[model samples]
Target: MLLKVALLFAMLIQIGAAIIAVSLIRRTRFNGSWILISGGFVLMAIRRLFDFSTLFGNAPVFQKEEVNSWLGIFISILIFVGLIYIREIFNLRDRIDELRKENESAVLSAVIQAEEKARQKFARDLHDGLGPVLSSIKMGLSAIDLQSLDQQNKLIVQRSTSATDQAIVSLKEISNQLSPHLLQNFGLTTAIESFEDQLLGNSDIRFQFEATIGGDRFSYQVEITLYRIVSELINNSLKHGRPTLIQLSLSQQTDMLCLTYNENGQGFEPDQLSEHQGMGLENIRSRVKSMKGIFQLESAPGKGIHVTIQVPAK
Candidate 1:
């Protein structure tokens, strides 16, 4: 009698579990797979009810062989359906991850573009306003008649004129760096070449640029982004490392455009980018990721820095 009671209790618990499963799943989508799952649970509950009836009543409605066969078929169907449910869950998870990445990239891309627009506007303001004003001041100083002044006054005027000239030159250089016309008009390659030439001719720093790309240009956004990244790297190398030699390469392979840069100067920990990374390095990383491009950085304390980037033609 005790054994029979225990069996009845176990069967009741299983039926209850099945009822819960169906109720929960029914709250979700009603598809073929869900129907199979829900139906399997309902069938299991009904099968248990029939078994319970035999324990309490005089005779069984179904024979043991008949009940066993139905249970086997139902179990097989449930197993198959469970596998499909697991696979569907995995597929849905993968799709969600992909959508998340796309949304992140879109947000980052918008931020980088907004920053570029701000830089362009600020550059224009400097070039059109302060730059011209400074030049005019230099010219006015140059026009001053120092010959008619006393010796001490003439010397003061001369020194002031010299200072004004230097200031004008500095303003123009800063304005150009902010929004280079070459980058907008000539594309990335030529703009980079011009930058290299200007820096090399004026400063003691040495730059070697190699390009296998043709005159065909990337999209304006790509060209400008690449130019900004390169410029930041160059400035960092010059300011911090004082690297005597910097090497840059540009080439096209398959559907990708590649850039490789190396500086023969004291490098920093690549891991420290998060701690000490200024706007420049962070911007470079953000821009690359936003474009769905790959960026590789290798550096150590005593060694030099090497960076490689691969961006799609889009």
Candidate 2:
């Protein structure tokens, strides 16, 4: 009795599965593969029903034994071919995904290159157009005869000359920022060290930068993206986090270049930040993604912040 019950249960399960496959034909738009698979399921369920009926002794046979054997073989062929078709569909989908990623990366690289070109143009305009104008003004002011002028007028001339000199200095600083000559001439490590040197005595924060690799050059995209990412992080810490110490390290392991940055600052809950907030973190993430790299950040309220970035060395 138990064997009969178990056989009936299995028949019901096979019948239900066949029903499911038939229903999916509509969703699959009657694709040939799904049609084949559905047919296979239906035949298998019919075979199960035949087996269940045999438990009752001398079960009715509507077809010859040879006919049933051929049907079973047909069902097996349908299922095998349908599964092969489904596997090919998955493979095609994966290929499409890879192409999409490559296209996105190419677009991102072009955009970054255009941005760098604009920066270079702007910097060149400032250096060539405005720089000499300020110098000419200072020279004209110096040529004035202070000896022939009254005391008050002499003082006015001196102040004007001093102000012109300061303006020239400020112009140079802005031009450098727009397009960093150091970064263009030197590699990543030297550029970072130079930036750290500029910030050394300006703030109370203790900044430490270490690079395990020296004078190693990478693709322009990799070096520039990393420099901008590091600069953004440091600026965020100074502007808001009030960190007393910031440490950064760069190293290369095998074919990967890794960067680690830490700040002992008043960190906040990362989850609390809205989509529009968080110190340009989304920008940083996009930059990392453009290079097919990884960006991981960790922080909590009062626990400080740490970040790790890894990209292909090539």
Candidate 3:
């Protein structure tokens, strides 16, 4: 009787644990290892139920000495198999996670490379094609002998020249925004400061930019990646948030570069990142992932927004 009670208690515990394991695996994302782990737990639970039945119930297999020996051996074999599977599940899960990250990183890198190539092509067209034509137009207008023309004609020419000048300026600015040469020549710090100046002039925002990395330059890819990231963050702040001040700081440690950005504006809930899917946010994250970097965001309504990024420099 005591043995039967113990067997029943063991069976109940195994069933409870199996249920919990199944519940967890069901709620989680599906994968082979998860299924295998869940199956192993379930097998252990069923084996316990069989043990209870063999000990308590009048089963013919338990009644015969030789048959009982074979039944115990079969049960032992299943228990060993289940344990082996459960043990291997850890290694399988880790391998799957590593492969997933590698796959994601490769996809993002390809997309970013394609984007950079397109930007380079567009910038070249603006700088080489439209830029020269606009400059010539400005020069031709200047060479026009306005004194020979009637007063009304001279006013028209002057206005046309002024509009042409503005157009040329806009073209240069837009081209630079696409891909800045300063980043490759001067370094990350100069490129970022120039961007801040542009944003400062175009909007009612104060930018405080600082860099402690000196004038040391990184590879063109890294420089451009960081530049685009910072530029986008500032653009988002200006476009979405009613902010007065935006602050950015950069520093470098051994093999790692860190950027910290803050905006004093109407911020959103931090949890929204998990609950909501925002393209702008996703773009930022994808860029960081391609750089093999870490991105973090902190925000709350009516308070402010803070972002910290760390990327490998080497």
Candidate 2 residue-wise lDDT, 1-314, digit = tens: 99889888988999999999999999999888899999999998898887776766674465546557977998999999999999998999999999999888778768877887898899999999999999999999999999999999999999999999999989987887777778778889988887777755677889888898888888877888889888888887876678999999999999989999999999878878866557488778877877888999999989889999998887
TM-score of each: 0.76, 0.87, 0.77
Highest-lDDT candidate: 2
lDDT of 3 by residue, 1-314 (tens): 99888888988988898788778875766644555556656766776777776765677863555554655566566556656765787778899999999888889988999999999899999899999998999999999999999999999999999999899889888888888988877989998988788768787788888899999988887788889989888877776677999999999988999999999998888666442335667788899999889999998888778999998896
- Prediction 3 TM-score vs. true: 0.77
Top candidate on TM-score is: 2
Which residues of candidate 3, in runs, are more than 4 Å off?
Answer: 1-78, 202-204, 272-277
Worst 10 residues of 2 by lDDT: 58-67
The weakest ten consecutive residues by lDDT in model 1 span 271-280
- What is candidate 1's lDDT per residue for 262-310, written digit by digit as tens? 9989888876655455556777888888888999989988688999998
Clashing pairs in 3: none
Instruction: State the displacement of the C-alpha of residue 136, model 1, in Å, after optimal TM-score superposition.
Output: 2.9
The 10 consecutive residues of candidate 3 with the worst lDDT sum are: 270-279
The CA lDDT at 146 in model 2 is: 100
